[model samples]
Target: MSEVQVVRGEMQPWTDRTSPRPALAALLTDVVPANRRTLILGPHAPQLIESVLAHSADVTILVRSVADAQQLGEDFGPCLQVIAGALDGLQTPPYDVVIASDGLDRVLGYDSADLSWSERLAAVAALAAPDAVVVLGLENEFSLLNLLDSRPAAERHGDDEWRPLHDDPSRPVSVEQLRTALPWTAEVYADFASRTYVRADVAANARPGEFPTRLAVAALEQTDVPLLSPAHEGVDTAARAGLLGSIPTGWLAVIGAQPSHDIYTETADTVLTADQNLTGWDTTISGEPVPATELSFDPGVVPATVSAGVSVESVLFRLASAEDVPGFRKLAADLGDWVTESRVVLRWDDVVYDGESFAHGVSGWVTEEPVEKEDLLAAAWVRFHERLVGQHRRHPWPPWMLGDDLVSAWLGMSGVEAPEQTPATSPDTPPATSEQVARGKEIARALDEVLGTATGTVDVRTALAEAEAAKHELFELKGHVYGLERTLGFRNKAMKTRENRIRELRGQLQKVTAAHERIRGSRTYAVSRVIFHAAQVRKPKVVARKISRKIDRKIRKR
Candidate 1:
């Protein structure tokens, strides 16, 4: 078993937990010399160490963390020589191949001398032989990630960032500066988590239809954190401005000997390498070459053929941003025709179009499931609609036309009627299952969040406008309710007045009936009734005269 050598004071409890980078490991496989003395500086992934060991028999690793050193000793056994100390205390022979891709920040111990970034770089360079191949990484302080980072300044720095030395004057900021700082012929790459690397020169010269720009955009999009703005916009803007290479998250410099490929990227555990030709890329898994056409990243999801062409998403964005309805409609119709003919489904950003035909981009994603033409068209437009709205891209559609309505209009332009239920799901479009609809919504929401306008998340102005509208509606409702109450109160008072008049009339009729009954029941009233009947029979004229007089008296009283 290999033994740990403590050269000076060591950081006992620390261990670098940086994720392993398969793309970086694959790159190392090309540059590391066969059967030569190699020195790996700082904390690197086990996969990288294994890659270096595959090419070299004698390997030495220098780490400031004693825990990491001991773990390496146990993992590699006699194949590796582990040194635990600061970079200043290491005393070793010149190595034919030197790797410090983790950078110089974490290599300093608590008891070590305070060294600037340049001084530490010089110290690492001193350990390299005259003809050695050196692979070094330098983190960019002004990276696009740093610029878009939404975290506060204090939260961004952690325990490992105790001595970042980001303000050192002699430190290089760009790929060109890094190249000039190195002694040997250097090839630098814009490193994005070591999962993807783009040649600096290639990225700097990338156009809208090129592979480097697409790769840069894709790499920048592979983040799970909240950012101040979308990284893809920044990348695209920089690429268009011919300044993409100027804002790398980090730069990986290879000295003395360059790697065989211009770019290295790992997706779905498969490492893909591409040259400057940009025509195609080769994929490998577990050191064995995999047929590019058959490579699948997910179950039932096949990868599209890699080619060079104009990104459909970029074209759509341009048309929308310019508010060119005719141009956008034409493109949509053409795109719909292609999808109908090809029977393939891919994201707009993943699909590309040449002058003659549509093809998939170099790293395009595709699914194998057969989808209806209307569903496919609706899916495409839905995604486009989300991006256009979420990013606040100007379009010819009315401002009130948003979400599904906007998508439906866009679909209509392609001559496909949107489903009455929803753009994503409709009984007419039976091919789009419930699961598919849900997934599509999920993807749309995720895209919205990435664009910094999530579902139900409105801007301050929109929120205020909605609030004002609600307030106005409430006020109108309150006024209508008050009017109804007033009407009800008037009706109630009129009914009460009629009831009092009816009660008074009933009381008067009751009193009149009671007086007549009492007079009839009395002896005088009986006799008077008998006499009036006799008079009606014997003296009809006299009875008529008495009745007329009584009627006159009653009329006078009224």
Candidate 2:
């Protein structure tokens, strides 16, 4: 909106293949406060900092080193604040919005060379203003195996590589024990983002040089530690309201799933041109609901399905549990798709890495007699639960019965339409109550003081109290959430059973309708033609045949 421009250093995507930073900047315009101190984390080019400047006045860019900061400052003088030091302990100026542009992904795992990505991110979030917004972006570039390749060759097996353990500062990991390693790191950032900063905004910036006029951005970063993602008043509105969300002290996370790193520019343009009504408001330059290229009963296509030719066709997994009743249908795929400039809103729980396991299609599911189960997705889900619960040692949310995989699925489930623009929550949220109003006053006062406080970053009670008051409000929301859950739980069980019945009835009805239609349409088909020519035949006994033969002989002689 600020006279957007992209100085293509490279032969900018002749199409929609531009750097995502600009789109990211546009999305941040909605989340970042009008103007406050802002922090940019990691080794992004100065271009991202320019994006921050476009939205807010007071901005600071935090780099890995002071030298980089100085150099960056020279490039974009006076407007930049660079902190050159160890990321683990660097002091950051107070900021309202923090952008981590594909920077944290570098330190995601245990690397002896630097602090773990989680450590750096959590540390930065702690440095932010209590209610400040942090926008952490990770490129879909690295693979899960990159974390496992830390093992030294001599001590590894099965594509073994030297693996570093971030949590265990003194220990190293073996390759076979790789599955356990990836989540611990993924979990850490997942936890830190959940804790330090509530996702206030989630958006996809465009691929640099892509879409000269319009860009494709997918946003899933919205948190609730006094954070929020506002549904804009008009359609195609990026993030608009709910300035904050609560990140309880114990644990929380923000997760996203990128189907592919290689996005199609031609496809995006085609879809963009096709969606004239949506271009103005609700639109996605590039998002294919189904994984584009399917495989030939390939187990690798769906690691969760594991066996050759054994797969899952479909299961009732959802994102928002409270999907409007009418919006959901047993026969239709009506789930919501967030495709606007900044539409896809995601929580910390939606993140899944390559190692976690997913199937591109439900291949290998058909057998002589297919093994159909109520929760067909459960077998693979066991590993998912183990990862979230056993591997990461995180809380088993969404009721204990729903393992990590299902819970993760629900965590990522989306709606048929973008969530309606509303206040962070309704007046029904805790701040509405008398006690809550008092607590809110307390929290705001504390927040004001904490931002100005010189020391006491971790020990800051005002921030913690504000977190607590909001948590209490969340507690109230949790109650209603659970109440809706109880009602939905009953509905889900009923629906599962109902789906089975509907399937059987539909099968039977299809058979009956096909048989009846076939018979009605076939010209040769008739009740009297049971034997094909039965109507032309008359009963003929052996004795009658003999008498008729003799009479025919006498008649012939006469």
Candidate 3:
């Protein structure tokens, strides 16, 4: 078995926070079966682990960090076994479900000298029962976005040891590569931001119905720009040009045979997960199962009732025919534009239909975030106005039908008071009196003159004073800046002068020390020193006579 680190006590409280990177929690819930023996290869995410535990499934997590394993063990009690080791060391009875949320190539130590990537994949396959499902997550190195970003923003900082693990030759497998690696053919899904996954073919087709990430949509709205970066523009262009599969950010490959799971039927209302309502049939419409995206509100075509003061994430509108699909898309787009303009957000999931106009067929609009009913009502009014105005231009509706009462009712739903205005008459209607026409023309000329000039121009004197004050402030700031520079220059010169003086003193001191060393080492000095020492040893008078005789000899020679 590989090295093990065991953690077996209480851990710090697990406070939930939003994950900055895309999370696979929602996708895991959809794919993994309930009440089964499941094994997770990595426990990097506590929320994902907790979400799996919520399904009443027996789960085992294999983690590299003992502390993380210990925390998982502590937070989840005996039900969850947090093993601290590599995948190679894991030994257990065959599991019904195995999930490698942290890419398969990474867990295997692809570049390690001990094990090859293929061997690691085989080792993981051995852990799965014959009928068990295995899910593997992988990054797309060739993702079109990857081309735009050679080095990710996250990795620009120095610590990048993890990059090699992901970029190893064994990883970021293509669909064909995945087929070759796994024993059984798998269903490969390409994902956006690791959250939005679609069938490989569907993604590659780049249909108009494709939904973008909420963050992406929100960013576009903020900039009031479409496709700001090359990466952003690449995705849209690729999807439109049927090249999404060729360049996906990540892949979720489900290996082994897919098992049948029971559908949930407890609630009449169907809630969507990860921007998708996975339940094929709506329980609210009928107990019977219908293969449609929306519930069949048949037998009656009354407008769907949305309760006030309640926050909703999505609303379904049944379309009359497939011919209306394009028109419905237009309406959805218009609604999204209006919502964004209001600084609110609403995203389109897709437009789906099943033949019967009033029954199984429906078109859905999803909000990026849950919004109040009033906001939804305002969005609906915008949609209505677009539709009405468009039709009114080509084939006009009678004034009464498009009158104040109708507009007012729509506005009242959103707590807005509709502005009062005279109903517009048909263009073919009779002309007005000559006197009335003359008065209208005069009013038009006067209004044009007022608008032609700048109506809100400031007083010239006030503007001049403000500009003059700004100039004075600029000059004062420059003066202070100049004074600071002068002071710095003086200090620099003084420092240089002190350094030069120190250098000169050091030169003079070195010369004096050299001369003293030369005098002490001379042969004559050594002889004289010896004679004086000998004289001193004999008598103090003899030492004085020897020093005087040496000085006289030296003076005579000079």
Candidate 4:
């Protein structure tokens, strides 16, 4: 369908149903899916029980519940609301038109909820009978709408790296929020607020005092009832009842740190002027009938006939805090449809605002370049590794792989070679020397790393040499330690024998220690990123045979 009709500003005697998205019903009529089962087929679908009731009833129905769905005179049709736990066997398809409305979107869009969006949708979808139509509604631009339309609001910015700003002072509940919060079309209860900011020194700081600086003959407005001008500041009790001096009207409320007025005031409602132009539009939130009880966004009324200059017309409700970055960014997104290039300014305390409006003097401050994402991940990884090493050094499994034997089986690092392996001992026997255990651990770590990074052709003899001396402890095959898990007889006895061998190793250790002394002295621990040779366990026998032949040839030559 073409865009629906849209209405703007205060209601004019002349009405235009001409536009595609009528500003009033823009969202409900077109935005939502008009399927058979709007909500059941989706969380947004209307209730089957309510849908059935609305289809055949002329009664002023009150489908009482959370965010009650009531049709006073049936201007449209039906509505529904199924609270989370109250949905007794919700899968039983009840309604033909299920409208999930905008509420479900809030659950899905931002925070982390128990059930994901799709999960919720699936539950609702399964409820549908065959061919049941499910229509779900979500505010595509949720945050933006509030900036341009909501009343009192707040937003947060630069609160923290993770949670910078929240509860923005600028973002107001949007007309949609109002519709969902209250029970009316946003336009029915509101007006497009146009104000020329009245700066004490400069031209209007915000707006509303756009035209007419002071009173000449104050514009008189009457809604059959006397419509007082909101501007004049004279203390005339006599004029107070019937005559309000020189204030232009058309503001519902104002909310800020030191608001010009109270949270709400009545003198802002639309009063008919002699010229028939809209004036003094004090918005009434709680259904107050009199101007005395009427609340406004700002406190004081505007004066009549002020100087006119650069004029700006914008959406009526902007209750968002200018300081809330995410919220305002959301609002900027909503208002983006109504305003030009939207942005959210966040103050990173001990930090600067980074922006791009320098040409307009609307630029920002930049203290430093933002941190990169990779740096964050790297930092997290290092911290995790350190924590694991600290807490699990004695574990036979490497701290890095965590519990994933498959993945841990392939982790590697540079700059470390296997230390010579000693032997292991059981508790029934004397505990093995710390030196022996340390050597085995070092070799194990090195072997794991080599497997993880090894490449190219296999070198057999070197592979056998690098194998652990405790190999028998893990293998049925002697002299070799395969990467397989769970060996049978090899563990206990082999470890004992290896321990015995190390005990007998006392004499050989001196020679080995002499070689180690020289080797340890020259140890430069620098890593060479060279490709290591792959180990082919079987080929060691072949290579050994060739070595023996070369040795015999060398002996004959000698």
Candidate 5:
């Protein structure tokens, strides 16, 4: 093996308070497996360091600051090998994994005068063994959220170093560019709100209006919702509603000799869109496909049993009543035929259920062609509407009053079409009659009344500003309360000390008073007093007479 090159620089010491963003931490922990030799580039996030230390062995970190090296050295002791210097000449052995989570662009890209992004990445890659994996977190320059919000929303830049070169922010390096730069097969994962990563495979299956910008709209409007979890805001709802298909917020690139473990795990039953586009059952998860089993309920208008070798549309199984079978099947077939004739190109993959033996039933069909976003949903709705109408005719109820399931399925499929940008109107419109004109006027008046009652005005920008000010005030009050609490604690301790001292002095005073009383009652003190009075003898007789009287009185009393 050749000696490794070490690059040293007089870099500024690490000073900014930094911790791992949850998404970055998740990316690192997912890519770098346990008990493997790992090298962390830059000391941006301490949490990432701690995670590597806990999960891997013989951890080596390449940092640029002496202060950072000393701090990290003291933190991990002999367990970590902290190297403080430039990246151009680092002499180290190739390891199993190399992680450049935060400030990758700065650490090796522009922060170093000697290296470009390509050179920086190469230097880091040199430390990785042939089979070693490299994981990097990068900013998406054309991030949809940033574009939509007209602000910097992506977690791409760090405070450790300023870029030496200025580049167009609008023209970020494409995924293809990244793939070409790094050695080995590179897989990029787009980070969703910096919480979870959405794979590009799943993203390729997206439909219109469900792209990253539109999905982020819900999250941005409801700003209080946290970005760390996809469940917050409307991300989970949007994912279930089929919005994120083609783009993601940011990227985490994994490069190595071959394909490594996926950062995310998806199940077979997962739904990626509202129109049954990209269901989990359609793709093999973790390299294994879920097997099809016999559905128990009678498939009303569909197949009774799906054969193992033959492929069909995605299936949703449920138990249904026997009475509703014939009508449901007839409607489904009519819809399937109509949809096929209309160029929607779908096959009714059949609903199969065994009412006599089993309880489970299945609904949904396979499509013969790629799902077109426009027509498939309308065809499904027409079929559902016809089925609902037929059921209503028999039950003496309205179409909307049919079985809840039938109504819901119809509504869900009906909503797939994006609303028109402009109201439909014809240039050669027919003139209205007097009666029609009067009715229109009355309707307009009613609408105006409704609008007047329903609407209230708000200055959105002003409200947001006020809310922010209130938040800052709340934090200030919290600081003041914390200080008051500390002062109270100190005063209480002082009061306790003073009380203890007072108790000690009281005990000493009590001891001194007892001693004074003992001394005054002694026989020596009484005899000395008598002798002194006798020596003063001008009135010795009188003094003697007084003493004798007192002695006689004491003897009588005894």
Candidate 6:
């Protein structure tokens, strides 16, 4: 059985919580020399140790934690020699293959001398034979992941960061600096959490539709951190500007042995590798080839060459951001036609154009069931709407138009009406009822929650600013409404006063007309009218002569 050797300054009651990295294990399949003396400098995943053992029988692992060393000794039995001590205490022959993929930060124990990053790197190199292959992993302090991280400073710098020596001047920050610092020829890979690794130079020269760009984007999108911003957006922007390699989360440097593949990616069950030709990927599970039909999800199905062209979603983003309604509608119509003809339910981001026709860039998620064309279209558009709004992507659409309304508008633009009951079902099942559609949407939302795509926390500053603006707008609207109501009330009162006066005048005129008609209808008034007419008709001269004669006779008698 193997034995644990305790040297000077061993850390007690400590365990390195590093998890297994499948991509790193796959990389070791190519780096570890067969039957050669190998040394592992820090605590790594057990799977990686097993991989090293698979290649070389003579192996030794040095870890600062005594418990970890003892556990390693027990686990491997006679296959491994475990050393529990600080790096400075280890006294052994130079190894032909030295691997420090976990970095140098954890190699020094609490009781050991305070060493700078460069000094520790030099010590690791010193332990390597003249022609030894050294594999090193270095985390970047200024990586995009760290920049976009939304966690508090205290939470980010935990107990594990006791002596980070971040301000050391001799430490390498970039790939160029790292290459220059290494004594031997080395190949550097832009490592993304050990899930994906791409050649540094290739990633630096990536463009929007290229394989490197796609790989970088896919890797960045898999983050589960509460990011201040979307990681994929930053990756896309960096790739477009030809600066992707400059901001990788970490770097893996391999010296003495060259990697056969330019790219390495690890899924849950498989490792995918692509050579410089970039024609296709070679997929394996634990160094054994697996059939394509056995795989459930294949992330390595990106375009083989630049000729495959850009994704439809990319074009849609451009048009929507530019607020070119006409252009967006035209493209939507074309996409609708393609979907109708092909009857394939693929995501807009997965559908690419090859100058003449649309094609699926990734194929594993295509729907196998027969679904109505409109329903399929609605589902795709609805998903797009969710991502567009959830990611806070700018678009021409109004802010108030959301949920089904926004999805309907998008479907309308695509020359297909939105389904009344839209389903968000898996590719294998076709939705049949409204209940099913509702359940499907719920499942989709749940999936988003599981994936951490919907960050529940809003930016406190931005939310407060928006709330203040909305409150001010509502207050002004209320004041304007109050003024209009007051004016309307006064006008209504004046109109009622005029209406009452008109009614009073009409009553007085009716009384006067009744009195005149009564006088005209009375008998006395009729006789008086008859006498007046008689006097007018008689001769007034005869009456006056009779009166004068009578008056002259009276005067003679007197």
RMSD of candidate 1 to true structure, Å: 8.6
Candidate 4 TM-score versus the reference: 0.19
lDDT for model 3:
0.48
All candidates: TM-score: 0.76, 0.28, 0.45, 0.19, 0.41, 0.73
Q: Work out candidate 6's RMSD over C-alphas.
A: 12.4
Give the higher-TM-score candidate: 2 or 5.
5
Candidate 1 lDDT over residue span 402-496, tens digit each: 76666666667778754445464555663323333444454444444432234332334444556787999999999999999999999999999
Q: How far in Å is the alpha carbon of 116 misplaced in model 6?
A: 1.1
Off by over 4 Å in 4: 1-89, 105-113, 129-134, 139-558
Q: Which ten residues in a row have the lowest lDDT in candidate 2?
A: 8-17
lDDT of 3 by residue, 67-165 (tens): 556666677778786676567766789999888856654343222235555666777789999888788777677765455543555653233123234
User: Against the correct fold, how does model 2 do in TM-score?
Assistant: 0.28
After the best TM-score superposition of candidate 4, give how far the Cα of residue 458 lies from its true spot, in angstroms: 72
Writing each residue's lDDT as its tens digit, candidate 2 over 307-369 gives 111111111122123443233232122221211121111111221212223223212111122
Which is the leading candidate under TM-score? Answer: 1
Clashing pairs in 1: none
Query: Given candidate 3, what's the lDDT at residue 468?
Result: 85
Note each model's CA RMSD in angstroms.
Answer: 8.6, 28.2, 28.4, 32.2, 27.3, 12.4
